[model samples]
Target: MQDDLGFDRLLDDDGFVARLLGRTRSGRQRKPLYGPDLPVVFLVGGPGMGKGRLLGCVRHDFGRFVPTAHLDCGAPAVTERVAQRPELRSEVTEALREMALQFGKWQGTGGALPAPRLYAGLLAVATSDRRSSTESLVSEVREQDGLLPPGTFWRGVLSRAVRGYLAALGGLVATPAAVPIISAVLDELLARMSREGTAALKRCYGEYPGAGGSPELGLHTLAAHFQQGGQGRENAEKFLFRALREDIEAAHTSVTGRMTRVGRPALLLDRADNTLGRRLTRAVLEDRERGHHDRLVVLATARREDGGRFLHPPGHADEGRAATWQPADGGLPTWSRSPVGDPGLASPGRGALLVRMPLLTRDQQEREIARTQGSVGTGAGGQGLPVGPGFPGSGPSRLRVETGIRRLSGGRPLFVSRLAEATAAFRMPEEGSDWDLLDAPAGTRDEQEEHAVADVLLDDLVVRQLPEELPPEQREHWLDLLSHLSVAHDADCAQALMRERQAEREERLSAYRIAELLRDCGWPHCPRHFIGDLGLRHLLARRLYGTRAGGAAWREDHTFLRDRLAGEEEGAPDALFGTAAAHRMHHHLAADGAGNGHGAPGAEAVTNYLARTFYTRETRDWCGELLAIADVPLLGGPDDRRARALGAGGTRGGAFHRRVDKLLHVVWLCEDRARTVDDAVTSTLRLLLERLSDESEHGAEVLTRVAGEWSERAGNKQALLPCACTGHIR
Candidate 1:
């Protein structure tokens, strides 16, 4: 198995612990950030960027020096902590009591206890037998050298409490009339259990007794008050939050009692942007604001976007607009409020830091490539031995393999690691290296991105991410979904398309497949689809269905996705104007080599779609990017064997000749990307004008209007140049 040794460098950043402990270099720690208040550090990045892995590294590094709790917010036990129903609340209380052992198990022992691991061990023992009595169970466990160690006062108390808590938990439904009493019993039990558990653990950790936790209020008193007032009895979930914090603080007190450790215990919330995580962090902050101070450090992970919305971290908000409207007179504008300021809030992450993880740089990527290659089970760089099929017997010459791996992965760690593993399995491309580099130059940045995503990465991704168990039919389904997703404007649009198709599935996609697929492609967590992971989308789309499919098949799928999206978007006219316009126009052209519209009522909508993109001011910039990538490959280059195969068009060259003709005809109609409205209208008008000229199809007046629109603009600089001719343009 892969080990924590791999992440030592990432975890052991100098002063990282000092930042949390507020320690000086002189072994004297001073409070940092929001003074003496325990800091809440947020570890943030985009999805699939390995936040969870970093959390694991943190636990590994600090497991010896300090106690920590790793809470998976998505887990049912954690999330149900807020449930209001009586039975659910009982279950929650029982879970928390069992969970308290995570920190409590260090009781009477002079050592550190990482919360999750301790509790997981205790749970294994406690759950090993539901049939045995409390004494018998604890005794049996002790006899077997289970997690619940014998000969300790707190362990004995904890064993009894666990028995009672479990009994009370199971009796909630059977004793329906006593639910309020049972609920109160559970809460009081949790409060006492967590408190005593921490108290027993409060001795000799790292230089001092940590958090000194005791029953501030007795279980009997709490139970009496809850019974008399009927307050805490109403919702057993109330104590869950209080108990969670108490346990952590208790653990801290236990570790640092009497002597000043000058440091706080830590709580690591995995997936902190999720339901339980967000609520827990906010609750703690709110408690602090309400003058309920506690000495516990918190570290959580979130997506980059949520780092601001929920946690209010600095540098997360827009600092300033690159294109701000300021007065030209060299004086401050009438506006007084700071753009990023929060009223009455000096700092949003008051005592915290939001550390954003960046992707691997080129040099780092090269090192990682070298490491992966060298570790491929046989000292992969050994001399005079071929690494795999087609490899040079003396190796591919140092850095050749590294360069190839880096180019394929773009330095994203997951991709780099995944591709590296695949290479180890076999150095030859699994799908076969049909991909060729774009040797020709392109004018725009988009083409370079296209080449990287489509030409460089897609095939490798397919071979890596797709599961071996994936059936052929399902593979085709996934391909169809991916290709259509290429044109999606946002997550919502993509989701809608997926949902519509999902309804037709006879069997559901497996969760593992869904997760892997989602990881393979990034959604619109940024500025819609353009700012999304376009490289992945484009590459997957081109490889799966774009270049591989024949003419008829390509046309069929594109047309279907286009019409389905159009129909799905029929209700929201105002919302569908700009983004949908580009999709509509492109898909319409894919199926036909005709004008913008083909005379049906639906054709008018297609014409309006193109018109909307061409004319709208706000959409014009977006339209240009869309049009820049828009391509129609009618025939291959002069050197292309496929083009040569289609010799003498309009003759009996069969499928090859017909496919070539169809592509050319489509290009003849669409013209080129019109930079301005007047220029854009000519795209449609050119087709109409030509149609009219050929047979006076829409009358001379139709030709006249199209001709007038063309002249009004600068006239087409390059003709699309289509013909039913045999010889080439020469």
Candidate 2:
């Protein structure tokens, strides 16, 4: 129900459509990257990553000047409609109906959109229906009234076609049958069209399996060909989809394309990973590679990463690294060729450029905060208006909210809006400060502001988003299974846990099956990571630690994984970093409570693991691995009451145990950004540098650069302490 909140701005500045349309943010024309050939652009991200909202924004904002159409291929309404028409056997009919309507609305009277061609296809379906009569055919056309041109123009076109057809047939057509009348009307319309339009239609239809080189025959037999339902039908459907795009292109060229400026029609599809959407996209891509040319821009939202690989825009590839968003270098995202070959292509999707829909940037988050506070552009003095002081919308309060929300939401747009709205609406006590918001009680207190936000996120993003078609019992245990499995880093670990829990179920769940279910529900699937989204993973970790029957389930599960991993380490003694051993330590420390010092292997095990791998591994890779193993969410209740405690002062243990705790805190800062650097964090880095200095002459310098890198990624100012060993200060 929420509008895009200007996330559409991301798409307009040389984004998917902006690049295709050859326009900059200021509306100045630029040479299009794809030239006249439209490339399929995919917006890729995890669930709740705002793909749907971005598509909606594109349609709403861009539909004014250009012919734009949108369809949710997976929506219940669209699928239901398509299901009712088995003759079509796909969403093509439903999609074309939408496109025609949208195109008609944009062009108005005398519009050059191929309405007659679409009408011809509908007529084929109606006539092919075994239950159809002349009256039923009329009823079918009436049902599609909204998809046709204006009333006056349509009446004129139909009358002219009917009259011309009857005259050609002489007195034999005195009382024309509805079928023959409609067929003649279609033929007459096609006959009078421009040669370019006719050629496009013929080229598309000729490729149909049953067309036999006659576009006219293809038009009349489309429904019957689809009714067979096999490879032939699929091929026919492909050609038909191409024909639809061809129609759009032909219409645009004749009308918009003929003008002084060029305008391309845009098709925005949500959930384009669905079955019918895949077919449609495949048809377009295949046709393009086969040498078909058109000006119809197709932009789709995909929840899977493999739908497209992220690429930097043309000239900016050298500005920053590939496969990641660099907003500071001008945030233009696009899709590129897959790193893996065609054999490894994600099933049912390939050849399309995929750009990951980014989380809100820092600037975007601040803008949302200001908008939530009702502070528009500038004040009378040409300065920004006050965001107030001492209240929820005050500068300090907003910063606190941003820090907390960034930590909690990881900059997911929905979370940003929800938390900001909640903060703005909250009433503060006279003596209360902004810290009260961060220190709010956990979910046990349902009336607390923090609880409301957490509950909404839990239900909306996790629970309710589960595949509703799943059996009720499976749905019931899903959260518990996911919570426990969250500790798993890979499929092997996940399957180990699954086998342990098999005795509790009527049917055993494998890691593959669970992964499929999660993927179907829009969770990003990465082979190396069990749960990929940082926010969702953190939430699941919270549930694992807090929602068990005796609250001991967390330690028990960690103990189970730790013991299992220990056996693996014995089997694979040469595993780098003693991966299994390091993983075991992660679970062991979690089971014993981080920095709690009550574990079998003790702090010496962790120190040994680091000592063995720290010098051998690349610094960044080693840091990332260490962070991965240590960053378990053992903070507090669901509200994370101890969220702000990220230093050694609060950690109780021996020196090494405390160091492990501090290092985990620093790495977690990469994901859970804070308002500013705490002095304890800086001193912890300095202590780490001091330790590294003893190991090697240049080790301290390496640690300093690593700390600075973390600081940059985390947006943590003053975290890079003065290090005399490296002469580095920040």
lDDT (Cα, tens digit) per residue for candidate 2, span 102-134: 776765223545465556566555545545444
Q: Against the true structure, what is each candidate's TM-score?
A: 0.51, 0.71
lDDT of 1 by residue, 1-730 (tens): 1322223333432335444544433334444434444445666655445567767765655543445567765566643542532322233334444434454454322443234222322233232323334443333223212334444444555655556655654554355323333333334344546554544333211111121332222332333332332444422223334445644555456535525344555667776765456656765654554344666667777654335355554554443211111111222112212334542353334434565544555545544544544532223343333244533222332333344444434444555554443343233322122122211111233544523323333444443334334556677566556655554544555665556556778755543354344432322232334223433543454453445435454455456656765654422332322445455555564454223222222323433443333323233333332332133222111212112122222222344333333223323323321111123333444453444344333344544654554434425333222211101111
Q: Model 1, stretches more than 4 Å misplaced?
A: 1-10, 21-34, 76-95, 107-239, 247-262, 308-353, 375-410, 425-483, 489-531, 535-557, 560-627, 630-730
User: Residue 470 of model 2: what lDDT?
Assistant: 57
Candidate 1 has an lDDT of: 0.41
Q: What C-alpha lDDT values do all the predictions have? A: 0.41, 0.57
Clashing pairs in 2: 335-354
Model 2 residue 612 lDDT score: 63
Q: Can you give the lDDT of residue 523 in candidate 2?
A: 72
The window of 10 residues in a row where model 2 has the poorest summed lDDT is 721-730
